[model samples]
Target: MQRIHWFSTLLLGFAAASSAQQAAQPAPAEAAPLSAPVGTDPVVTQPAAAVEAVTNVVDRAADAAEPAAPAEAAEAPGQAPVQAVVPGTPAAATAAVAGSTAPREGKIPALDSRLFPRYDSLQPKVAFWTKVFGQYSENQSAIHSSTYPNKVFEVLDFRADAMRLDKLALARLKNDEETRAKARYNRLLEEVDRLRDSPQQLNEEQRRVWQLYADVPGERRFRDAVGTLRAQRGLKERTALALETSGKYMPAMESIFRSYGLPVQLTRLPLVESSFNVEAYSKVGAAGLWQFMPSSAKIYMRLNEVVDDRRDPWTSTDAAARHLRDDYNALGAWPLALTAYNHGRGGIARGLQKVNGNTLPDLIARYDAKSFGFASQNFYAEFLAASDVEREWKTHFGEQLQRNAPLRYDTVETKHYVPYETLRRLCDADDEVFRKLNPAYRPEVIEGKLYVPPGHVIRIPAGHASAFNVGYAKLGSSERFDSQRSFFLLHKVAKGESLGKIAKQYGTSVASIKSASGLKNDSVRIGQLLKVPPREERRPGPVIVAVGESKPSLTRAETAAVEAERREQARPAARSKPKAPRTHKVRSGQTLSSIAKQYKVSVNSLRDANGIDGSHLAVGQKLRIPAS
Candidate 1:
């Protein structure tokens, strides 16, 4: 439920960018925030395999070699520590108890003023974000001007269950809120416009709004700020929880960054991204601790049928370090690199070229491109404030707060491609404990179908390395496959075959079939090859142990077929109501207008069908076709 709310908040942040400027342009007919969807970064073709034999992981845990410190905060062994120096704040003057880890030669500069400059002019903006992290809760939002973030007009308190309400009730509530917001906006516009002319006849509330711009040196200040009003929902409560959650991964995460020669402060970014929700998945397919979209994630980490590395904190941290290292080398500054992380390097480069500015502050003040809106602009500021919130933890969340303990596990490389059952037997692991330690493995791998790749790093409970080494050495070759089996088998779609029949026959869900094939619906054309999951089979067991070796593998048996009603349940119930119409996949050269004309529906209906407000469409994007 919290993840859902965060996803919605991400969308609202996107919509808030353009909402402030609607007074200057024709607004969407609905003008609802959901109209603007936060799409994924540019899609890249995923390679076949992102990793080879070796992993960055082989370090064994020392168990008790490290203790808590102010600088490194190295709470556990095998956890490397480095502290980020806030720009303009001297290392000694800020805070530091003592350091155990020696400084490496030519360490990357902290988010310094030279690379990540904090102009006095942008303090209000930074302070606004500080409040976002420290003051406001998810149910509250502050209405302010996008042009001048400090000119906050009001803070809105929404019902706790506002987002959790049913669609119809939620819509009605949103409509009512929109009406109230419009009325408030009109009254503010009246007062601000009056200030533009009279400059003296201000009511108490109006004067407060007027005084917000007191530092402005122009006569047109009031008039210029008129159309820039926006509202930003707060994540204060979530961020506070994230501060505690961050401790579990922070020690190892900081070490990963230090290994990459990057600043440890980058660990705080997840506070802004997922709020430390490891299982978080955005609607656009981004996932995990770092929220790496599959398109970009595949380039740096392995994301195959059996495992998505993004879901694993340690593996994803390694990928994020490599990713950030590349971004910094390309962009040359943490500010730009961080911005580029959100808006994409191409987008940031374009913003720089369009604004003719090298600094993030300048780009924020000048970049008017619609794509570089609220989310992109606030990325850096949020990071700085997040880092501050962590540094000044006692001042905000209280000194008595208890953080989560450091994650303690030792990763060992597998000798060959193996099954989940075989690996579990090797470690003598409980299913739940094994899952917790190795979160990267997918459901297929967990269910004993997908083969765990060779050289894959599997985490075992601390102090179990010697036991695993002995057990693996006794296992026969027949018990462990020489190579991993593909997760799926190709099946050509035959005439009269429905996805439901094929999925039922294979003991898999229709959703799995569609996802594996990238199908928009159950419909498939004849002769099209689909990646259908192989039927369930008995798992291989240990053939040799305790002075015995090289025994033959046990024969598997045919699985019983599922009941008809059970198979029908795998697909949505067709008897409940009529099925939704087939969706249209946006091909090249297609627009809402063209698609609407092709389907004989209004363009507005097309937008409504897809829950998208704007006309922007990506190639191969899917859209539901509303009943005409």
Candidate 2:
């Protein structure tokens, strides 16, 4: 009976608790009303009214139960409170129902609030999706974050696991991109390295040695030089001729370089400087095989119109070698010396100072030296490349070159204008050979009686000393002639002065002045100088007239009549004279003037007769005819 009583008591309690829960929850009908269409008017809602009625009944019961439970707890004393029977009951249930049935508290919880924040702030809120995706996702969002939200699904961090996943999916593509980038970077580095290492590619000695050949304009220049060593056909004939003429001085140059312990390759420098033409003159007034400008030539070799020692290959080469040696000593390096050659020693020294004792490469990188232009900067490389090509070409084409005998010569001192042809004849040398060897001579004459200048040296062909001496004995002592006396007097017409004044100044008649200067209608330019040929000396006496005297007088009318008569006479003379013959052989030591004098003619007549194109003449040459 007691067990039944206890079971009945438990059943009663369970029934009461079930009844309370049933009351707290909305009825199915009332819950249906709460699910009315979203846009429906809330004020007219019968569903919300039913829900409120149920809620009020449940709240009233809970309030009455709360007071009664407290009163019972006070009556029972130590017993547990009735409200404590279900802790967190109403609040927990409300939260769960709100979470499930209502629009989710945070839509798309991982991405919603933080990434698309409700307000603008200095620090962005941590987006819900960004946190779910972790650090890399947050970084991605940070990268693209702005006030507007668009295409949110496309956000994937470059450093994220998603990127790694893609890489794994396309392994070949990732590898190819990486390889291409690395290769490009490495190629750039290699190019930089090549430029950096260029300064070291050649030693100072090698640089100096190669500079002699490298500074030339083209490979053909050096090839032409070497071609002279072996007789070859083509453009090398002139080069060979130069070599034959100038090579005689190479040994002397070599000796100078060796004296200074410099490389023998320096002997080739003159080949480029002046094409072995001792008389070569540059536009800038640099002369000789070394092509030294007037100022520089004076510093090294002696120069004067009478005796330009700079034209003496031996002397000039020696001087160049000495200058180079001095530069090398000061700089203590061959490369610097070579640079000094292009840009003077002082310039190189300043450049070196600017670089603070660095190597050539370092100096190039650190300093902005303008000397390294297209030609000058690559000058050394060109020399090296050219030398290599020339050496190989010579080795292969050696047989084609003509083998001219080595030049051998003796020096003679000359003070007077000995015609070059005369020297050639005396020395038993071909006129061509003599002219080639003695290029500094203008008019082919060495002026003044001096043993060549103090340093002036003349070259004679081999085995001609005794013949030259015998010829010299036959030639008479040198005579001096006044070149100024050869000039006819030119009288300057003063301002406001007439031809009469000029004639008076020149001791000639006005008619003579007008005739000589080609004055038309007796009008002349002011300050005009009329040329007056020297006349025979006259003795003071009264004029005498012979029978039939009509030689013409100095009066204007008489002068006009005489001129008219002369014009009439000249007309017949012009018609009667046959055209002068043309063509002539170039005689030894015969200039245009001398030839004209020999033929009792004018220089222009000789020029026209022979069709001579210029003042220069090659001895023994035959010329074309001119209709004089």
Candidate 3:
């Protein structure tokens, strides 16, 4: 009976095969399957050509299942897709999804998405930049503005480059009236130049307030420049936002300041420095909310390869407290102390001596030092303006502004050097949370160049101490989260190289390189091997040295050549057998009489240079004069 049943099944299979062969037909485009899985489980009745088509589809899908090409190679310009074959397995599918997210190749990689949420806390509040814009409004120096009539407004900056157009101007520039905007910009510059040359009339009150101009060389020019400046009324939208955002930090900053016996009002200093911008950096090397220069920060903060305390709001506020206290002690007045904060103690001291005055108003009016430029002169006034705005924000901005909640965090001291990643994981917080709490750590530490130094305290989310300890203990005894224990590259100095160049190359800084390599000075030599800090992503381009310090690495031979060239330049020009009459160039604010006195030559000789019969001497006009 079993043999009869098996024979009956075999005959049924043969009958089905014959039926499939008889129904064989060409495969059509519309008949293609949406997906193909390798390894047939069920047999279907189809033509031989259709079976081959199905096999080809399955082969292509299996090839696609291979891990995607590296993100950089796949995204390369004019790149073509590559088909590869791999064994049909779950692991291959898992890898294909994972490979799609490879780190992008670019000068600046996309910041971790987790960082986006924390940006508001780290970045300058919109209100802060708005306040900056308002401070410069109603002046003759505006570049352009969308909110104002004719889309133009004035800005004032001691540093020429700081007088940039605000967001409103930027938006207006992107409009169809860009040509008109440019014309208005040029007109503003011309107006400022014209005002600088034109004489200005000042009221009695204005003259008293601007008494510092009495002894200035170009009093008329300076007076006109000052007269054109107008204070803005009411708070701008961004300034209002700044006030609201600053509320979050006010509690912490005020607490820190009060702890150090500082006036709570001092907490508002960041309003002028950066509008409480944690990442604010200046061309002159000032940084953070407090705007501390490297030299000054070194006194009250830990500024080194592993950390820059200036960027940490809490740490920097403490440092600022110490500095402000020291300045008050030396100057015996808040006005002088504040001025010294901007102008340096030495500069303020020199100004006091030159003017023979102790009061800020008197010194400001009488002191005529060259270094007492516009920025130093107006630092206190700007502070006063910022303070007033903070005090009267409600009247100016109403209730439209929104404030951030106060920051809350707890601190933990590391028993040993710990990696940021390890500590972040131990605290069970995201990267942004970890970074926002500890902004003092240098990029090297964040990028994995170094570890949290031994005995250093790092901030973590509130109420995570127990979890932190548990996670830390779970790790092996030998897991000493140190950079040296991890992979790092050692670079050998070749020919001419500089700390700046090497730092840029490795996406670090001169200070970081110095701290890592234990360098004592800016100088480096050929064949000297230095440890290059590890970076998660290195910018691909030429080294970007700060402006005014673009000196490249120089070899021994090049240094010698530079020295020889300097010597040649320093050497006096070869004199003719008979010395020709020296010439004097008439400069602004200079008279013929002044030129004659300077060169110890007669005014008649200067007049005879180009037959100048009148006392007038145009600026830049070359005049022949007798040798001293």
Best by lDDT: 1
Give the lDDT of residue 95 in candidate 3: 32
Ranked by lDDT, the better of candidates 2 and 3 is 3
Best-to-worst TM-score order: 1, 3, 2
How well is each residue in 371-472 modelled by candidate 2, as lDDT tens digits?
443223322322222222222223322434321222334444333334445566676766556655565554314332222211123456534556665675
Please write out the lDDT profile of model 1 over residues 191-260, one tens digit for every residue: 7766666767767556565666665668777667665665576766676667656555564566556656
Q: Compare the candidates by TM-score and give the number of the best one.
A: 1
Report the Cα RMSD per candidate. Answer: 22.3, 51.4, 34.4
lDDT string for model 3 (123-196, tens) is 11222223443443222122222211111232222222225756466434333233443454344434444544
Provide TM-scores for the models.
Answer: 0.59, 0.36, 0.48
**Where does candidate 2 have its weakest 10-residue lDDT segment?**
65-74
lDDT of 3 at 89: 26
lDDT of each: 0.58, 0.38, 0.49
Higher-scoring candidate on lDDT, 1 or 3: 1
Sorting all predicted structures by lDDT, with the top scorer first, yields 1, 3, 2
